[model samples]
Target: MSIKYKFHDPGAIYFVSFAVVGWIDVFTRSVYSDILLESLTYCRKEKGLNLHAWVIMSNHVHLIVSSREGYLLSDIMRDLKKYSSFRIVKEIRESTIESRKEWMLYLFAKAGQQNSNNKNFQFWRQDNHPIELDPHLNMFEERIDYLHNNPVKAGWVTNASDYLYSSAIDYEGGKGLIEIDLLV
Candidate 1:
């Protein structure tokens, strides 16, 4: 879908997702995932992204986050996608393990054409569908639980808190391995 709405507001809760080109399993490696983690770190520490919840799936990412420091969520997403897009393409080209690189790139090109007037590659979907969250306690808790349980529901892990890549542990009042800004 075309990005019709440019969400530049800081205090908005966004539940965003970006699929891999052709829904390819590009996040099968630790390196790409590390890049995502690094982006989140940069968001929290530098860009003022206050993450309430997030889950890294095989082909997509789900994040419920907002920024309080007047930084736009769209800008944060643009930087992350641009950086990860280049790295992922480079890795696919160089790594012998990436057998599906050609097919994936082809599909990305197709999607980009369908989605926009992009010429080369499109790593993530352009639209980041952000829903404004109510400050009520129950609604906040419910969404947080959903984010944490996503990996467990997908059968990737036995327990929600066991998934180190997610914010489940942090929501459960434990120390998360990836440094996250405490939900604001």
Candidate 2:
């Protein structure tokens, strides 16, 4: 666990990507995706997270985010990941409609077994791979476009704004599922 990609500059906006333990399609169901959305909402309202862009794919999520003044970006990310991982895994286990419950649990459990930090299951991977966004270099705009277009690139939707689980709608001047501070 190197500190190479860890959030160091609290004021710097970062583009981060975090995936499920085995790249499982855990977010195929709205139940799981909704949980993630709720977590993001909580992070924004209660955790001082300044979200500029975001997209929730089937097995992972991408975000361009920063912390408000007096808050640490790393702390916000740690809490968001920790809380969402626990809640999402719990939801999967308790979901009566989840057809792949056993399989998903097995995979998560196996991943947890390999990772010493987890008690029983590991939902998200340990690393966020945060890349600091440089607005002067136009990396900010580039990353935001990439984040919004993720679902479109994956063939989930023809237009990025049509993707319901992304902030593309916000960028398009439409209300999105979660409240976001638009970058573009």
Taking the candidates one at a time, how many backbone clashes does each contain?
0, 0
Top-lDDT structure, candidate number: 2
Displacement of residue 6 (Cα, Å) in model 1 is 5.0
Question: How much lDDT does candidate 2 score?
Answer: 0.88
Q: Give lDDT tens digits, candidate 1, residues 1-184.
A: 4664356456767666677766778787777788778878877787777777887888888777777666777777777777778777777777787677678878877776776546677877765566666667465667777777888999989999899678888867898768665564
- Residue pairs of candidate 2 with colliding backbone atoms: none
Error of 2 at 76 (Å): 0.8
C-alpha TM-score for every candidate? 0.85, 0.96
Work out candidate 2's RMSD over C-alphas.
1.4
lDDT of 2 by residue, 10-97 (tens): 8899999999988999888888899888989999999999989999999999999998999888888888888998999999888898
